[model samples]
Target: MRSEMPYANISGTAVAIPVTGGSLAALVRLPTQLPAPTVICCHGLLSSKDSSKFAAIVEDLCQAGFATVRFDFSGCGESRSASEASLLGTRLRDLLRVMAFVQEQDWNNGQLGLMGCSLGGYLALLGAADSSSVGVKALVCWATPFDLAGIRTALESGNLPHAMATASRQLGEPQDLAGLPPLSRVLVVHGQQDATVGWRAAIEIYRRMADPKELLLFEEADHRFVDPACRNMAIQASTDWFRKHLAGSP
Candidate 1:
């Protein structure tokens, strides 16, 4: 691990995790406190661990005494591209691997939280629902789609990545959030004006989930939360949610 001090009270480490074909590039940031609660962040379909929104949230999380892990899901950012035929499955495995890696690290306190954006959010849900993710205490999904069907047009038109388009064909039917097992504490944030994925997806996700859930809709924000103010609000809310749920984990 390559370590550097990003802040007076926080340190950042760059690490490469081995996967099927190649290693996934990741950055692990921790506060001065040892054995801190950790939050693993997943980027969007076309985004990376270095996303401004993700960076902001990671900084906030670290300042709040939470360690954060940000990594690229194969084919995006610095991670090697995965096979087009197994893009979705490969990404899921990647997340599970990262989760396991974090759990084994001495800095982790056995308490875990997950945060994901867009497609990453969907993957986060899948990861949290898996039997192996029993240690996950909370989740924050931003601009997450309840179903993948809505993006078929974008996938087909080449607006999205070819790997996802190909994987969608193999998967056949789109999976919905309702199919996921009962989730832990969840926070669903969306923008009412989101053109990519409608706001109703957020409602569906919120409704399908049990208690300890919340939905935040920004009237002027788009799918990416492009507005500076809206993005900051979303980050603050997510950081606060993780703080509440993970910090209180028993």
Candidate 2:
């Protein structure tokens, strides 16, 4: 079941989507017109649908006449479970469920794009690559870690335990990225100064991805794009990418 309410003057809707554990809270920003191609915006770890960055991006996307759906992963924000209990796999499942819900929405135009930040970005790529039937038309990831081995190294060297290595072994690498028919119409953005998920990870993703893809690296930006200019640039780029790929040429 789902419940919705109007969102201020933005022509947006506050939505509640049913999932495995409970509800996944979301905000859907729509263009003035109907049947707009939609972008599913996924927030990073420790963030929710109302994050300032996501809000700004949604505004930009809506202004460009593209509908946007920003949602919290399973356990975060107003969702049912506690954040600590949410695992990587659980988050992926939650996103896939959200994808299904988006497909069923009346405003969606059958074209779907995914835009995500940090851990959310990683999951977006994982879903697009691994799930052949996911139906995503385009993808954008910011500060995402592409290689699990690199993540394991960064974590262990930063005084954290070697949990990522174990995750790699248990979850296994995404098979889609390993060979042909790699994800298409992909865009990867990374901050050169991003210490969390180094820029090299973005390169790794770009290298593995099939053609019709792009990579953008901002030298002055940090992991979260602390610089306002950098953040705006990233948002605009994402909006343009979705417009071109999802909405077709102007």
Candidate 3:
């Protein structure tokens, strides 16, 4: 069941999703129409559900007559933090839990989409690849890495948050994108000047995906996409992709 408590000072309803250890903090924004297609937004390693990027996308999606949900992964944002031993595996579980929760909501029309950034994007791929992610029709990945090696390097070098560095140690083997089955319609967006993850990762992801895939690269953008023009382009592109693929939910 969804929480009834009123969330203060937010445009959407605040939800507290029960998990094993605690709960995940999430915000749900609904369109004027009922039973609309739903999209879940996932933030990067250190970012939260309050990301400006997510806010922009959610606004556009709501206006397009789609519902959107943005949640904080365990140990990030408003969600309860985990122990030092907690790793990507824990975060994956959190995502799966959110997916399950969304499916149970009456506001969802059974058509689910995912939009993720950086590490969150990688997690979205893993969730969609999982056998349990039913009703997921499409996904969009932004500045996502193809493998865990670069993440491991970033974690070790203190480039990323220190909390994730300890978690990286437990991420035994590197994941293989080739092993992922063609789960759904995929859109890969990357910045040509992305020094953090590099544009090559986008190419690799695009190549490994099946048909119904697209790759968009911006020459002046970086991993964070700090520039307003670049960010708007990515947001518009993503919204267009979701609108096209998640047209009719049965």
Index of the highest-TM-score prediction: 3
- What's the lDDT for candidate 3? 0.82
- Candidate ranking under TM-score, highest first, comes to 3, 1, 2
Task: Summarize candidate 3's per-residue lDDT along 1-250 as a digit string, tens digits.
Answer: 7444432223888888888778889999988787789899988888999988889888888888888889998878888745334467777888888999988888778899999999889889888888776767889999998887765665667666644624445653335466767655899999999988888999888888877889999999999888899999999999899999985534
Which 10 consecutive residues of model 3 have the lowest summed lDDT?
1-10
RMSD (Cα, Å) of model 1: 3.1
Candidate 3 regions off by >4 Å? Answer: 2-10, 81-86, 154-162, 165-169, 172-176
> What are the per-residue Cα lDDT tens digits for candidate 1 across 1-250?
4233343334467788877777889999988888889999999877899988888889988989999999988777778744445446677888998998888788888999999999889899888888865578999999998887755555556666534624544433335677777685999999999998899999888887777888899999999998999999998999899888888878
TM-score, candidate number 2: 0.83
Model 2, position 224: C-alpha lDDT score: 94
Q: Candidate 2's residue-wise lDDT over 37-145, tens digit each? A: 8889988766788889998988999989888889877646776632222255667777887888878877777888999998889888877755544688899999987
* Candidate 2 backbone collisions, by pair: none
Candidate 1 regions exceeding 4 Å error are 1-11, 81-84, 153-174
